[model samples]
Target: MKTLNDLLQLGDPRLYEVCEPVQENELPMVKEWVADLHNVMEEIRAKYKFGRGIAAPQLGIMKRLIYLNLNTPSGSVPYIIINPVFENLSEELFELWDDCMSFPNLLVKVKRHQSLTIKYLDENWQPKVWKVEGAISELLQHEFDHLEGILCTMRAIDNQSFKWRPTPDSN
Candidate 1:
């Protein structure tokens, strides 16, 4: 099982390359990849205390896969999104301090669509569509950008938009 140590950090050339879509034949192997992503995300959350989603490329898998474990009012819901395609994006936009497992110590202030519709294959390789807004929308956009070899730092509002997360000792 892969741990947080296995996560590719910012500036890794592999993270800058566009990921390939998960092929139908690879569905059987996707489970292992998802497991690795989940383990790494969970390890990140345990150590850094913040992690909502992770993309396969972050693990050097170079495949179009994202694992999200969102905490909803009802409970923590996990999703394995494969080969996601954007169907729509709302004109309304919002900005937030986005953090990533790739660079856990820094935060990048960036703009993101307030809402988006996406079509993707689920863990079972079944097609599904979802319309998400607010935090979920922002999270999805962040992960989707990874598939295109884009990082939040590249989308920073400006040079001044970069900042380091306060360490526990500092806080």
Candidate 2:
């Protein structure tokens, strides 16, 4: 697997439109992509020391997939969600300041649910269901949005009032 650069900025047509589904036989390739994503995420985490997750589209793969690693006391355990579907979303909404690798340096305040239930296949193709809350919940929703061609910037609450900074050591 190779390192992947952050996705193209907003307004790029690639950032919009639904992504194609991954096929059964293509699972191997998806795994490879996931590996590459994990690698890039590790680098991002080490540098930024805050990023907890990344989606495949952030690396230019227009697929319904995401890789997340919530920080814990022990260490990071990577989680892979493929072709994920959301369920049991709370009506209660909350605002969060979000940043995306695809649209680096932009901090957009977006509204998201306080909790969410998601269903997706694991690395071994086993079905898994999980409910997330707080920051983890927000991270999942943000990456899920990437699958549907939505960027946090589009959902910014204050319109064009957000700020953009150059990603530290960004090449």
Candidate 3:
């Protein structure tokens, strides 16, 4: 099974390439990618104590897919979003520190739409739409950008907004 041990970092040209849309007939292969994403995201969250979602490009797979393992009061719920695209975004926006699996050690202060609705296909190839806000909204945006070869660093408000997360041992 593919794991998180080989996540691509910044400067990798592959990370800048847009992903191809997944098709219904590709579910068999896509399922495996979802599993890999789930395992990798879970492991990264446990190890780094960060990351709520991840995109396929981060794992060197240039596909329009993302996996989100959300922890709620009930239990953890995993999502496999395929070919996700924002249908609408609120005019209002908010700024927050954004991070990515591809660039784990850096935090870019970026602006995102305050509210957004997205259209996507689920693992079953069923169409779905969702409203998102707060952190998850930003998370989805960040991951979706990966599908377009856009990184959080590219959205930095300014050069000053790009700040690296301090290493644990540096303190």
Candidate 4:
């Protein structure tokens, strides 16, 4: 029954604070956070039918953890990125419209690297590295920014590029 209200909104200052690296003992709570994230995503998907990922901070848990339920051409793949850090970024950049659960009704036009290398710990606390491009790469950047207390609005290319989310009828 949990929905987007479970997520922290844009005005919450806690979203601006950098999250701490999750520790071993925090697994129990981390799991709960992950569950909450999944539930929120599921609720959103059932209604909106689209989502990619979410960060712990979005749930008001200031830990360096993120969950992704990606819909790939092959199939759906779930991910848990703990304490993620970008290893490299491509020189190429592209502009795209981005949205966030924190500010669900707004879309921001932002420029991001076309591709990048990222390293992080999995849900099991195991190390993981990925060379991501296109939508996945963009998705990671958006979620990662939350760990640094940055929002898509902050990443917008210009004041004019920011916009309100469109109604389904408009789409």
TM-score of 3: 0.94
What are the Cα lDDT values of the candidates? Answer: 0.94, 0.80, 0.87, 0.87
Per-residue accuracy of model 1 over 33-112 as CA lDDT, tens digit each: 99999999889988899999999999999999999999989999999999999977999999999999999999999999
Steric clashes per prediction: 0, 0, 0, 0
**Candidate 3 backbone collisions, by pair:** none
Error of 1 at 5 (Å): 1.6
lDDT of 3: 0.87
Tens digits of per-residue lDDT, candidate 2, 59-118, equal: 778888888977689997889888899999989889877887665557888889999899
Q: Candidate 1, after superposition: displacement of residue 83 in Å?
A: 0.4
Model 2 bad stretches (over 4 Å): 4-6, 165-171
TM-score of 4: 0.93
For residue 143, give model 1's deviation from the true position in Å: 0.3
Per-candidate TM-score against the hidden true structure: 0.97, 0.88, 0.94, 0.93
Q: Which stretches of candidate 4 lie over 4 Å from their true place?
A: none
Model 3, C-alpha of 115: deviation from truth (Å): 0.6
